[model samples]
Target: MEPQSSLPDDLLRAAPKVLLHDHLDGGLRPATIVELAAEIGHPLPETDADALATWFAEAADSGSLERYLETFAHTVGVMQTASAVTRVARECVEDLAADGVVYAEIRYAPELHVESGLELEDVVAAVQQGFEEGMAAAGGRIVVRHLLTAMRQAANAREIADLAIAWRDRGVVGFDIAGPEAGYPPTRFLDAFEYLQRENFHFTIHAGEGFGLPSIWEAVQWCGADRLGHGVRIVDDIKVDEAGVAQLGRLASYVRDKRIPLEMCPSSNIQTGAAPSISEHPIKLLASLRFRVTVNTDNRLMSRTSLSKEFALLSEAFGYGWAEMEWLTVNAMKSAFIPYDERFRLITQTIKPWYAERMSG
Candidate 1:
């Protein structure tokens, strides 16, 4: 196709992609946020869409993780009612499909949307309805699933985990715990993780971004997270000498040997100070070592990125061609929380053929 190493934005945008770490609240369109905020009487620093977009980017550009998280307040503030949540969720799917995402698992905290007297289950139901509407409108062009998340600082893990298991057949595919990862550890919700395991459900934990190897260790070894969210910190355990020789510690070796997928969000990592920059992201080394790395956009609005943007940045930094791009997309497809047969069908029937056609032309 048109010069693999220098593939233009249009080609990258047309490539079928898979995303695993996107947040529903973090990816809202600025206009939608403005409208929703005005309807709910939630005041924003800037009411104009462009100004609000710039505000989110600039506010999240602060190198402090805490500062980066503060940008979500406006997004979450505008999504309290069922209609608003459904609108945001439906728009999220539509946006992803427009960006050529064939399959995605969009995550959100139901607890964060219950301020309007809507029950947590109602929040889940609203988002699920929105997803179905979005999928139907797409005519099966994209498949969307939900990852029910519990705020780490809250005490609702057991409740949200139960909600996920109860609604597994409805739309929920997995469980997660998100929020600050400093004083609040994944161990705080071992019961929820164990419950998910006992019920034969899948889950991923947010670890190794704001914290270090200890957080990753607790999520993997203690709580048995199926995948590590923003797991860029696993690099902490590996030692690279002056001569470029690499030595893997026990924990690093375990993660690598077990083929644990690291849902690495490049721009978000840079904004959160987890990684210095996209060029220096550990995804380069981890992918090179075959550590089951997957690419994602943690927050589209905050980072002003799409899946294509992430691939474009990686292509520029690492000179990745079609083969490497396919490798990353397939890795994410294989690590999806969807059932094996479904995941395989998407890979074989959709992803492979799409990329093969473009790459060979």
Candidate 2:
């Protein structure tokens, strides 16, 4: 018999979720994209909102991370002006809040939004403004923060790292390196990582998704990432025997022993060919092994998913119950880049209480 959760969709939507790996540029509403693109006269593959949504999903499902990223051109293209960027950011928060996300750290590359004469600082400010508006509009239902990202292939990692630190007190909570992981290793940004370390700031690296064990190894061992973005490939180091006994390689063991968080995005991983499907995704095995595993929706528009939807899919694929859902959510809350007291408060006051109620009832 397959294990399953009695939790229904409505209950799952009501469950408080904490997201750590979402991309701001990847979560804009289809209608918003249509209007923004029209204002800038940017050509889209599809004009109709529904058709554009389908196009994004189809384009991202290409199985090559490089090709999947090509879809961002439309999103990044439309988000040139400050107003456009702010609108996208605000809508991102609203959507996540409606999906029952209690806390989120939305990451985006400021460098990508400066095409139309806006400075990098302007981009960050616009996103911050949007986040504030969305939070107030949600009536304190959600708390959102920024994670400024530097493209791994870019040479300005140090600048972006500084930008993250500069806004740390405002709304930005952390920093990250994203983009293709094949040729652009995390070590390339050693200076920025070193700077963050010196400042005692938090950062995550995109690893073990498009690439393999070597990428994850560098992000963890060399770059000292606080968390691994899409670290599904860590399973490469584990050997499972015929009798179901599992052997952990040194790197894998180190990650687990150290309690390094894995920001595993199952649907996004499948679209990028990191894992063949949700059932075969390494998140299941990693979670079972007691690795600090957390679920995320890397891209809401492209993957057509939300935090709740991601958990629902996981529950369906892995036969996870409310207990498992609570575990994954608490793991994300613990792994968040916020301060210990704040994380502890949310885990205790908000997240756990809801789960306790559902489980007990």
Count of residue pairs whose backbone atoms collide, per candidate: 0, 0
Can you write out model 2's per-residue Cα lDDT over 1-361, one digit (the tens) per residue? 7555566999989999999999998999999999998887999999999999999999999999999999999999999999999999899989988989999999999999998899999999999999999999999999899999999888999999999999999999999999999999999999999999999999999999999999999999999999999899999999999998889999999999999999999999999999999889988889989999999999999999988889888888888888999999999999999999999999999999999999898
Number of clashing pairs, model 2?
A: 0
lDDT of 2: 0.93
**Every model's TM-score:** 0.98, 0.99
> Worst ten-residue run, lDDT, model 2?
1-10
Where model 1 places Cα greater than 4 Å from the true spot, the runs are: 1-5
lDDT of 2 at 270: 95
TM-score of model 1 relative to the true fold?
Answer: 0.98
Q: Which lDDT value does model 1 have at 29?
A: 99
List residue ranges in candidate 2 displaced over 4 A: 1-5
